[model samples]
Target: MNVEVIIVLVALVGMLAALIMDKMRPGMILFSVVVLFLCTGILSPKEMLEGFSNKGMITVAMLFLVSEGIRQSGALTQVIKKLLPQEKTSVFKAQIRMLPSIAFISAFLNNTPVVVIFAPIIKRWASSVKLPATYFLIPLSYVTILGGICTLIGTSTNLVVHSMIQEAGLKGFSMFELGKVGVFIAIAGIIYLFLFSSKLLPSDRPETSGNEEEEQNSTLHLVEAVIGPRFPGINKRVGDFNFKRHYGAEIKELRRSGHTYTDLGNIRFREGDTLVVLTDDSFIRTWGESSVFLMLANGKDYEPAGKKKRWFALILLLIMIIGATIGELPAIQRLLPEGIKLDMFFFVSITTVIMAWTKIFPPQKYTKYISWDILITIACAFAISKAMENSGVADLLASYIIGLSHSHGPYVLLAAMFIITNIFTELITNNAAAALSFPLALSISQQLGVSPMPFFVVICMAASASFSTPIGYQTNLIVQGIGNYKFTDFVRIGLPLNIITFLISVFVIPQIWSF
Candidate 1:
């Protein structure tokens, strides 16, 4: 490697360390690396800023609002009620009923909101049916992730990869193209969960007293709130923050990773920590929409939109998906204006505007709905990928990979790429994993003189196959805290699913897309 590659590689290692250590917000950590690249003359101003304006990044932002509108409408909550068993049910039966429908919903919408909406409800339902919430919550998060890979709009990572393909002067993934392989993976993964998840997951029941249960049924609510990056009290001692004074809620307990702290003395707050707070009726009304918390577990706290508004929001979402799908057809492309294309960006933008005008979500408070930190992380991820390519680091790494797997052929290379990407995703952000792996995948394909499509598909699958760790995916983190689970719980159950997804992606992707 030359001086530039050495510099980029050093920076890459430091960035990964910072991200793993939680030294700063993921967005800032990624943005810092991009700035380092810019200062070292490895990236231009246009290249540095290009990700901020990427169509994929913008679509993610718009989809956030669309998800928020649907979330506020209470449509998802309504759907969950119907999916759960009315009376007591077995864990296997519950998974059979709930997992597939959730997977389908997640394929159409964002995964975080679906988990945020369904997790608490499912947990509560599990309690009602005398089943362990731990058995259901992890599967809920995993199924959404499985569903997301089924379509272009299923997850932000897919869109990020699609945008990179377009920028590389190739046609991006059409709607449902990923579904060819993704559907099979979803089916196999779900079946595995149905058979083994109940036995593998812990049977710990949520602790509650008669008085606490009565209070829950009354106006007082015990809420589980996940700390967001924007929360001001992060990194400070709980005693110093004065939670009751600021948010008008009492922090009765806090759960971090898998440990529960009821004393709350001298505990420093961290992002993603779940706080079980005792709140009155006005608590959700006051902070439900705030960005301070990633999600509030009390779905019954909010007054959903009117029936007409709820149906309207659902119809609008379908229109956006259908419109974007149809726009990609060759006939529709030919009918469009010379300089214009009716892509996801076009449809999502229009749908967002209509929702705002019609008051699906509050128009004035729209900025709060968007996760700016994630947006920043994604934008910086693109720049980081470009820097790796420009500095020859991607080529250097690709050559080594090809050298190790050449005798075994592309099948081995595909497995190696999947393993590397999946590890990065398990340790850090999924988008960052995709960004880091994309250039390398492209380089490997070019070196082998094969289609890059299978490599790209593998990156998407591996980056999203973050089933083995709670930190790998946001939804996993959400469920981990509420379920009071240990890190080993994920390893025990999720590791098998990880292997299953890996096998499916390696064996099935090449068959469908051709190497």
Candidate 2:
């Protein structure tokens, strides 16, 4: 290989190491690598920054506003109250009643906010019925994840992958195109959870040092926080970091991967480790905006601030989905120029503006609602994919995989791609994992002399199927802290579902899309 290719491969290795090591945020890590490639003249400035203006990137941004508007309007919360019967006490009965609806709603909304709105409500309901919140919280997160895979806007990862497809000069996914394989995966996942989650999920909540009376008070915040790259306590043992003094928060528990640590004195802070913490209302003001925590679940649901505009927000969202889906029809495509056409980007942009104009969600706070870290990670992903292509690293890796799997057939290759992407997703952000895998999948398709569509669909499924680990998906992390779950809890419940999705996606994807 040439020196340029060698440099690119070396840089990729370093980037992967940093990401897996959890030394920095995925966005920053990716952006830094793209910058390195730019400075080395491997990628031009325009190529480096192209992701910023990408249709998928921008669509995700707009959807955030749309989701925010719906969330702020209180429509979903209203629907939840009406659909979930307060009298239900049995775990199986409750899940059967709730999970399908959760999945359906999550299919339309963002996964994080869906969990955000539903988690506390479900927890309160469980407490009233004398049921462990643990049983429902993990399932809630799982269902949302399953639901997210069913639609393009369901998860940001799908949109990121779709954007990469268009950039690669392929026909991008429609609004419901992913639903083909995704719906099947969702059904299999939900069934697995329904059949097995009760035994797998933890039934007891984590105990705190506080008295029963103190625990009963809602004012005593029980929250979960993930250490971010900028967290000051990185590499420092819990006893050394004096969290109570520094942030006025007590670390009740620390969980990394599948292991739970109660002996905080010896535990060092690491990125992606979930910490169940106890603090008060002031914690939101102090650390809400800090990058030190990738996520914080305060275990309190805010009342809908724009309750009056609920119907308006819901209507706008529905219109956006329907309008975008219809805009992709052949008749619609015929009317527009080859270069210009109405798609999700157009509908989402219009909906976001209407929401802002009507004050469904304050336009002033629009930027705050959008997760810049995720957007940056996605934007940098495009540059990283370009660097891989320009360096011939993608082709090189493709050749090796093709040689090894030539006899095993493309089905084996599909399974391998799914496993790699799934593993990467568990270790890093889903969108980042999808971005890194897209170029390789395309190259593998080229090497096999088959359609790349199956590879792309597998990448989408694998990246989103992060059931085995809390850190694999953001929604899982959120529920991990809120539910006071141990690392084993996820593995117990999520592994089977992970396998179920793996099997269904691998067998069914090629059949539908053809390789």
Candidate 3:
């Protein structure tokens, strides 16, 4: 009824329209929305800038550096090499090999980067043994969807929901806590891929060039490696990697835990680690035969997969993640002194200091690793969501839903909420979807007199249920563009995947979390 509220509604509509049209970069659109609100006096300039001050926003930023450190250290690169399909000339065999880790890694890392690192590599591998790129690309996106379910930081949608829950005076999930359910879902998905992906995934296009089915595959490689717990490179420098001189393959990227790194030399080596290297196939095959580095893809899980070094980045990553998770626990939160958090800023500073001193990611260049656009988008999203709530739009919708479902039990309420949120996410950014849905989930719980647990789960699942459209989830979009896929391609595969996700979340969430 108020003029300000009306303005907020109109501005939100404009924002959504901009996102759908792909009219401008999402960050730009959100910034414009904040500017419009300020000029119209809808939100004070201070309020518009509040998102930048958010601990959650900073935490997201730190995650990027953490990811960067892992990559530079050559951790993820080994993991990719070991997991890819063998060049045995069997399409099904390779798909089976690659899908599981692809799915698992996607769950913990930002799916887009995983694809960026894997797509070309996998495509090339596919070509080496005469497999189609189309078959792998779809599965790549699908697995990311499945894996994202397992961790608090596995996807931005999860973090956005966690932040919303905390904002509403509720405790959020712990890191890998969601893995209890997510891993099961991933296992089932990998099974599905193994049994059906080869048959159902399209390979209509051959490996040949320019028959029109060719033209966009084979830009990455699968080099094997393993790091023992006591390599001197654990916190050492890339310049120390004598293997580069010997193996003739560069450590193009690394993975530790869920992060990826491209700054190779600065990364110190570590034990129990793996790497994915990008080199000519002939070089990989020749090296695999010689046994210079233990080839994980060659069946040694714990062998030194790459040249031995003296460094360890995984320990720091584990400390930050575990520390942050425990700190988030209610009892842990109580024990801590006031005003401290395990946030992005906290971890970013901590990780950066370690990496800088080790010359891993020199502090001067550390700034380059952070994805500022994503941070800006996140900050601006906060302002837009705030405006929606302040204007009563979110409350109005929540009230309507409460009336419609008052007679129904929480099961129907939970299912309805998840379904609605899932649909909304498919159309817009998942973080935005969670932000817009949070108030409604909380208000409805208040009206129903039930604990908000079920609603909270719905918000988490709905925000991440990005199965129906590539337009909504960045990971899907990246693969689609790189894979050169048609829009309907996602619709055909994604619709069923969405249904499975919804069914599992709706049934499993209440059972697991006790709504």
Candidate 4:
């Protein structure tokens, strides 16, 4: 490799290390790498800043607002209440009733908010029915992931890949084109979870007597909160910070990884740590939307919009989805004005404005609803992918992969690509994984003289097949904290689902899309 390639490779390694070590926010870590590439002369100024204006990245930001409007309307909350069994039911029966609907709903919205809104409600319902919450939480995360693969706008990773395709002067994904392969994967994966998840997941009943539980439930509010970067006590011992005095709550227990500690006197607080706190019902109302905590469970403080408002929000979302799907048709494309197409960016922007004007979510406070960290991470991911291609690193890696796998045919090459992307996603952010693997996929397809569609589809599936670890996906981390699960718990159950997805992608993608 020449100097540019060597430098890119070294920076790539350093980026991976920083992301794994949790040294900084993922957005900052990725942005730093892009700046490094800019200073090294591998990328022009426009190339370095191009990601900031990417249509796909901007679509993700708009979708966040759309999701928030729906969330504020309490529509998702209403759906969960109706899905849970009113009477006692077996875990299998509950999964039958709940998982499929959740998957379908997730296909249309952001997965993290779906999990955030559904997890606590499901956990509370499970506890009331005497079922273990652990059995359900992991599956909730996995099913949302499965659903996200079914459409172009279902997940940010798919949009990121689509953006790269369009930028390369090729046709991008239709709204539902990925559903050809993704639907099969979702059905098969959900079936696998139904058969084995309850048995594989641990059952840890809370330690409390009937009367004590009854009294605690009636009198005190038990809430679970994850620490955020804005938390004042992030690096201080609990005793030094005086949690009860500042937040008007007592930390009854602290959970990190799989371990639980009751004596939190000297424990230094960290982001993502789950704390089981004993406080009054007013606690959630006081800090529900505050930046001090990443997420607060048992959120009973939110007020639902009026019935008319809820219906309006749902109808608006449906219009956006249907509009985008129709806009991709050839006839519809021809009817549009020159250089103007009615795509997701167009529809989502329109929907967001309508919602904002109608006050579906607060109009002036709309900025708080967006996750700027995730947006930055995605934008930087695009620049990093461009750097890989500009520096010759993607081509070099593609050549080595082809040398080893070409003799076995393109099927083997697809499998190799899936494995590499999956590994990166399991260790780092999925957007970054898709970004890094994308250039290599393009290079490999060009060298083999085959359509790049299958390669592109596999990257979407594999980058999102992050069932084996909580670290890989935000939804998994949210569920892990709320359920108090061990790292090994995910391996026991998610590893099998990962294999199932891998097998399906390698064997099925080519059949549908062709090399």
Candidate that scores best on TM-score? 1
lDDT of candidate 2 over 1-515, digit per residue (tens): 99878888898889888988777778899999999999888899999989999989998888888887888898988877876678846888888889999999998888877877787787777888888888888999999999999998999999999999989899989889999988888888888888888888777665443445346876776676766656788888888888999888888778765456778898888766778777888886667645667566665665665555887788888898899898899998898887876788988989988899988887886887787888999999999999989888889988888787866878998998999999899888898788779989999988789999999999999999999888777778777766767788888788888899999999999889998
Pairs that collide in candidate 1 are: none
How far is each candidate from the true structure, as Cα RMSD in Å? 1.9, 3.1, 11.8, 2.2
Q: Which ranges in model 3 have alpha carbons more than 4 Å from their true place? A: 85-92, 204-311, 326-348
CA-lDDT, candidates in order: 0.89, 0.84, 0.66, 0.88
Give the true-structure RMSD of model 1.
1.9
Q: Each model's number of backbone clashes?
A: 0, 0, 41, 0
TM-score of each: 0.96, 0.90, 0.75, 0.95
Q: Could you tell me which residue pairs clash in candidate 4?
A: none
**Arranged by lDDT, best first:** 1, 4, 2, 3
Measured with C-alpha atoms, the lDDT of residue 10 in candidate 1 is 98
Best by lDDT: 1
Ranking by TM-score: 1, 4, 2, 3
Q: Name the lDDT value of residue 291 in candidate 4.
A: 64
